[model samples]
Target: MNKKGESKLTIVITVFAILIILVLSFLFYYYAVKSMSFSRSETASLSGYADNAGRKESAGLRTNVIIFKPSEVLPQQQKEGYCFSTSVADPFRQDAFRCQVENEIFDPCFTTEEQGIVFCQINPLAPEAFLIKLEKPLPKASLLEFTQDNWAWFVKLEDKTYCSPFTGTRPFFSQDQIAYYGCKSNNIEEQIVLIGDLMIDDIWTANKAVLIKEKDNWAIKFLEQIKIDSVWQ
Candidate 1:
């Protein structure tokens, strides 16, 4: 009721209010940091291994070691032969393998529009085969025309077209085969998209190529083989 009593009361209230604010702030910061650390650990764990379904295809599955990217955004800044961290949470649960194609040499920043996928085929009698899925898609006409134009260089042995329609758990087929999947619109026939091996040179190194949009035109650039320690099923 006195003046001194009133002043003391006001000071106590102010101090309590400041203490409450400080406690709330500390709690908020603690939780935020904890959530972030957990998220990063989960991401790293996922990146360490391939999908269970993918692992089923082959028995001796080993982790493919390459420079792993923190995430899949801005593939342009990434290096070839590197595996992106975004692999685990993907629909296919596959890692993105970066391989240097011819066009990439000219423009190192050129990257896939979507997440690229990589896998391997198991063959007991033969060497390991790899499959590379490109994020970019080409129309049926464009693919056919490109194949026809480069028939001499693309087709070897018996001039057999090395492409097939893929509609399975995997996003794209083998690197040696042209994977025809996806459609631009409802009419799948008209807008059928093409991916996978865009080109295979019979000459020189027999380099495998993928289609990349350069300026206004689509260019076929060859990719050199990046030998990984293990084959991802």
Candidate 2:
């Protein structure tokens, strides 16, 4: 080939290579952003699943409003009521009721049998709170002790299986005459696990639990249990 023609051919090849590199880089960036967006949306939806469940329970009951600081202990007066429902906003009307104490803001509160009034300040340490009603009311001390000891088991069961459990929140269960505890393990991933007869399905974004009394002690059974096929494996 002539020297001029050879030079032109080399220039064209170099430009083509650069164009391919640019296109590849753009594609990579696009997919990375898309993946991140999907992750965030999934997380939000999972969180909303738990919150919405609580709201649904709250709507059915005649609830009262109470307010207290998270830093302080749950007042003895409010201890009698079971927190069947919770919310980030004031479920009551704008002027319905307000917290009497200073720095006591309503982040999440509960509905109880007594006057339906209860309040709690938002605690960063324990962000998630659950409403658990037992089929039979056990002594307050025994219920607290039993739950405290078995909380680790619950955490392991929830996360180790298919569901991804939320962390940092202290486990608290309220005692009432109502049968069955409405406890759930929030799942981040979309998967299913089977524990014995129970099937933990992430389609609901949470796993429900069923407690059975065995003579002297109580046992917790997740409606959905361990993963049959784990991704870690």
Candidate 3:
């Protein structure tokens, strides 16, 4: 071959090789990103599916369900000793105690503040009723009372009610508002009774209240918290 022709051939081969390398690199990057994206989507799907399954299973075993989610701000009328009643004729019955200053509603009212809202478990006798004390209490009323039947998601088994407040976390996220409640003839198996937030290992974890049922009665046994690192892993 002539020298000019040979030089031209070499240039063409170099350009083709460079183009092949670029194409291969682009394909590798594209697939790598796609695979990573699929992994993340799969993880999210699994989490959602598992949560849905838990909710469905809980629904099958629940009875006398009364769901309640407290409002951040109370209405003008509710500010004065709000009473939660399911009766359509008398919705706001005035038999409940008012929320006073210094957190003195009753002895040992379990009060906890989460995300600026104060929740007081006023009546141990009535686990279904909780006093939601507003951050900005109205001049007439500082506390708004809520019953299980007042809101949207509590399961009552016999005399006891099982549920938890919303805390923007797993199991208790805004979408999945139903509290996990299940009943078993045998008391040995851990049944998910409530979904709530708990501090575990110095980190806030969305925990489940595992309960044991014996002879038609349910009692809490332990708290189960799950933290998934990676579904693929």
Candidate 3: stretches off by over 4 Å: 58-233
- What are the TM-scores, per candidate, against the unseen true structure? 0.25, 0.25, 0.27
TM-score attained by model 3: 0.27
Candidate 3: tens digits of C-alpha lDDT, residues 148-208: 2223222222323333323222233234444432322234564554453222332223345
Deviation of model 1 at 232, angstroms: 24
State the displacement of the C-alpha of residue 5, model 3, in Å, after optimal TM-score superposition: 2.3
Clashes of 2: 7
For each of the candidates, give the backbone clash count: 1, 7, 8
Better of 2 and 3 by lDDT: 3
For candidate 3, which ten residues in a row score worst on lDDT? Answer: 82-91
Cα lDDT tens digits for candidate 2, 44-87: 99989989998987664321112223333434433232322223
Candidate 3, residue 33: the lDDT equals 100
Cα lDDT tens digits for candidate 1, 1-233: 99999999999999999999999999999999999999999987786555654566454433232222233332233222323222211112222222323343110111233445333222212343333344443211111122122211011112211222232333332455553322223432222234433233322112333444555444444434321222111
Cα RMSD to native, each candidate? 23.5, 20.2, 17.6
Please report how far candidate 2 places residue 132 from its true position, in Å. 40
Q: Candidate 3 clashing pairs?
A: 66-154, 67-151, 67-152, 67-153, 67-154, 68-151, 68-152, 68-153
lDDT of each: 0.35, 0.36, 0.40
lDDT of candidate 2 at residue 112, scale 0 to 100: 37
Off by over 4 Å in 1: 51-233
